[model samples]
Target: MESSAQLVIFAGLAIGLIYGAVGLLSGFCLMSSMRGWLAEGDGRLVRTYALAVAVAIAASQILAGGGTVDLGKSIYLQPTFSAPVLFLGGLLFGYGMVLSNGCGSRALVLLGRGNLRSFVVVIVLGIAAQMTLKGLIAPARIALVQVSQATANSNSLPSLLATLGLGETVSRTLAAAAIVVALMLFAFAHAGFRRSPGQIAAGIIVGLLVAGGWFVTGYLGADDFNPVPVTSLTFIAPIADALQYAMLSTGLTPNFGIATVAGVFAGSLTTALASGRFKLEGYSSPRHMLRSGSGAALMGIGGVMAFGCSIGQGLTGLSTLALASFVAVAGILLGTAAGLRGALRVQPLAVA
Candidate 1:
């Protein structure tokens, strides 16, 4: 590996460590937030999520605007995308999140605390993701994406605004400001959220980490001879890749995602041990295990189909202001809503 790629891998480790620590401390998770707000009538965590989104948008756009990172290089900004596939995938992922009681990132954090249930989730999810990406499911996913993909001259919000005769800088500025302001207002409007400084800091830190990932790949990893992929903090494909690397260490070179995955587990374990929170846990019943396994499979497939998961599309992809990211996120929110309310809602498991 080139020196730059090695540096990027190490950077990924650092970023993942910070994320794991912060996530454990603050319990920053989209599924938890949705369940809290929709099922339990608590909105403070959702507000914290909103703040994170706002900060991510602000920081990412600023980096793009300053030419530090080319947001266009990211996969989310592809000129042609399948809205139907993305939406459907998001729905699957969101519903699966509820079934598993968390998303991929959350499962990783929980596993660090010695949650055996999360170990099942992580393994199943990784296998499923790999299947979707390269195994039996890959052909179907590729065909679906190909059949439904739509091409556009402007694939992103800012670019669309520019096509409407706005200057590039002005369009980016206006779109980012509008969205950021709206999210910030929603986040800060709640008195409960405002009173929780820890939640506030978690949001800010997580958002900055997203931007940091972009910088690591786009700037520090830039090379003429050996260029690293331009990506941020995404979990779906990375988890699958991590699993593959673990089994085939001699043949495969370690990348940012693999290093990050390892870092997250290590970081979370350290934090858990330090805080006396480490405990071995498993499913309450066979039925519970089955449900979690199913959810993990769905998350793997859906995340691959949609091109991301909650943290992937919701925070990292959206930070680039990609139009497809919006559609995917809307689908995720709707799916979460479906799981949290209405006839399709998943009932809480009975306590034994």
Candidate 2:
């Protein structure tokens, strides 16, 4: 492998380890946030998530400002985005997340803790994602994307602001800073959240890791001869790629995404073992497995259609202030609400 590829993989591994450790330590799942906020009236976890988003946006924009990374060249910043696909994909992903009781990242964390059920979810999700990305459904997906694209404008917050007569740099700074500061105020306002060290660490560490991912792929991984795609800690395609690489590493070379995926599992497993949190778990019943499998399938398909998962659109994409990111996040929020407390809710099983 090339030395730069090695550096990129190492960077990915470091980011993944930090993310896995923090996620495991803090119970950082969006499913928990929805459940906590709606069912249990708990705001701590939700607030922590908000803090993570805010921090990610601030740090990532700083990197962009310093010329460390060109955030505009990212896939998230595409000029034309298919609104229909993004909404549908986010809805499916969010609902599936609730059904499986975790997102892709959470599944990796759970699998690391010896959860066999998560193993099942991971496989199903990966295959489903791979199929959506480049299988039988690709034609239909392409057709829909081509038809429903909202094209013409810049499709970014700063660009839109510039259209309104603001300087590009000034607009980006104001847009990013205002959002981050508002989120920080809301996140820190809660006395309970302020007192929890674990929650604080998770929010800060995960946020930085998102920005760190941008740094790894956009800066460290940049190559003139063998250019790597500029991206960050997105799980959908990467999960599928990791699975494929596991079976075909002889020919296929390791990249940041696959390395990050592997690193998350390893880091989570190490933490689980060291902390004695590892435990064997499985499906509650055939019906439970059915629900989880179905959800996993939906997540794989939807994540591809929408071009991102919860973390992808919710935190990482949003950090760039992309309009499509907000739209996707709204769809995810709506879908999560449906699964958690709306008409489409999957009833929870009884706790033994």
Best model number under TM-score: 1
Q: Single out the weakest 10-residue window by summed lDDT for candidate 2.
A: 343-352
Quote the lDDT for 44 in model 2. 94
What is candidate 2's lDDT per residue for 1-352, written digit by digit as tens?
A: 7777889999998888877877888889788887898988888998889999998999999998888999888889988898878999999999999999989999998899899999989999999999888988888889999899978487888888999899988999999988999999999999999999889888988889999999888898888886677888889899999999999989888888898899889889999999999999998788888999999998999888888888988888998899999888888888888999967888988654
Clashing pairs in 2: none
lDDT (tens digit, per residue) of candidate 1 on 263-344: 8888899999999999999888888999999989999999998899999999999999999999999888888788889998
How accurate locally, in lDDT, is each candidate? 0.93, 0.89
User: Number of clashing pairs, model 2?
Assistant: 0
TM-score of each: 0.99, 0.98
In Å, residue 14's CA in model 2 sits off its true spot by 1.5
